[model samples]
Target: MMRMFLAAAPAVLLALSSAQAEPVAYEFDLSHTEVSASWVHQGYSRQSLQFTDFDGTLDLDLETPANSTVDITFNLISGIWAGAHHEAFVGHLNSGDFFDTAVSPTAHFVGTSFETEDGETGVMTGDLTMNGQTHPVSLEVTLNNSGETRDGRSKLGFTATGTLLRSQWDMGYAVPYVSDEIDLFISTEMAVPAPAE
Candidate 1:
């Protein structure tokens, strides 16, 4: 019994250690960033779009870096295409042909799994929901940078990209000139928690 107790000691201690530290929460910096998307419209020409706001929470445990997860929620109805394309782009995007924002006002992405493919580059599998439809997708992510600055501040940043079939979510409206491929882009910057005061 003493030997069994000794063998179980480390496992029990690790569990206690994990339970003591809470997940780190970080807010993204939007000012120094852009959230944009592109898709082929005429098989050769590409069209681009961007959203105005992104609100979400990210939870990470530096010890188990691969176990981190991020929840991002964005306003679909507030998206802007930025040009003379506003009228047709917004109208059609909000219509049944694209996002159908009238039926779904928001889009959400929640991380599920992480995998490494190359040196410091990886993939994050998650569920992406838009226009009342949800689908499992993976994003190619690269850990651009992570470290502490001279100001006693810690930081981490990454950029992710993915492509999804528009028709998978019922966005099949194409005038024979539009494409069904949608390119997604995500960039994030995070800092450590505030010091105890």
Candidate 2:
């Protein structure tokens, strides 16, 4: 009986180790990432805005998807308009009427939970902090691809979309005129960094 108990110990420890697998860490590939938003312009057309500077990190647990986590930070001053009147429009957006970037030059998001059915697509819920306000937001996310690159680097790509009310963050300057609802679109690629010598 003593011998049998000792023999089972090794198997039990192995099982525990496998169950506690650590997640893979990845950093945003900034060159391949894009974060942007769009809103209706007085019921006529949808005006677009893009944020150029940001940083993000991801901890992916493929074995247990629920353990995955993500975080992102955007520089509000990097906001840019898409069409004509780019300079003036972006300047106004940075003013108190819209983003009020002068007071809050940065926005941040931290994923609190990740829910998925097929592993390829799912919903991510998190808190978004912008313009001195924090609010819960949900994003529909889709995994574009994941694999090793030609240089032997592990990488993954994803796309996400969501919507938020401008008033929630107290940035409802235009409201019905520029549309209170803002649509968010994001596409990004993340990669594991190489070890330094």
Candidate 3:
């Protein structure tokens, strides 16, 4: 009996180790990702701009969602306005009145914590740095789908929405007219890199 108990100890330890899965690394599939910002334009309509150039990574732990993390960066210089007078509008947006790309060329977000009752949805809290200012922001995040590709690569998709006041970041050029509140919309697909031979 004593010998049998000792032999089982090693197997138990091995099983415990295998159960503790490590977080999987995933890179954003830019082709399937979109990050946009919208704000009310003088109550006439809501104006929107897209972040054309950006990159992000996710460390996902399916067994322990709280242990997951994400980091993203946006190139403000790549901001685009989809509207009439496109060039002029984009130029103004990049000027000092708005994002001021010359001064702060990039905005970054680092997720600090994620809270959820179920693994499919959660509130992600992170520090967002923009226009030389960093503030805490929370996004309602949803895991849309996750599966394995035909090539055996893992893939997952998510959608997130949040709102922030432009004034909080000191980019309030037109408060009453342009609407100080800014709404954020993000959709992204992430995938594990193909294994190298």
Sort every candidate by TM-score, greatest first.
3, 2, 1
Q: Write the per-residue lDDT of candidate 3 for residues 62-181, one digit (tens) a residue.
A: 566556666777777864546676888888878888778899888888777666655566676778887788887777777777776679887767777888888888888979889988
Q: Which of the numbered candidates is closest to the native, going by highest TM-score?
A: 3
Each prediction's RMSD over C-alphas, in Å, is 10.8, 11.8, 11.8
Model 2 worst lDDT window (10 residues): 1-10
Clashing residue pair totals per candidate (backbone < 3 A)? 0, 0, 0
- Against the hidden true structure, what lDDT does model 3 obtain? 0.66
Residue 189 in candidate 3, Cα distance off native in Å: 1.5
Candidate with more favorable, higher TM-score: 2 or 3: 3
lDDT of each: 0.60, 0.66, 0.66
Question: Cα lDDT for residue 170, model 2?
Answer: 89
Task: Report the lDDT of model 1 for residue 152.
Answer: 64
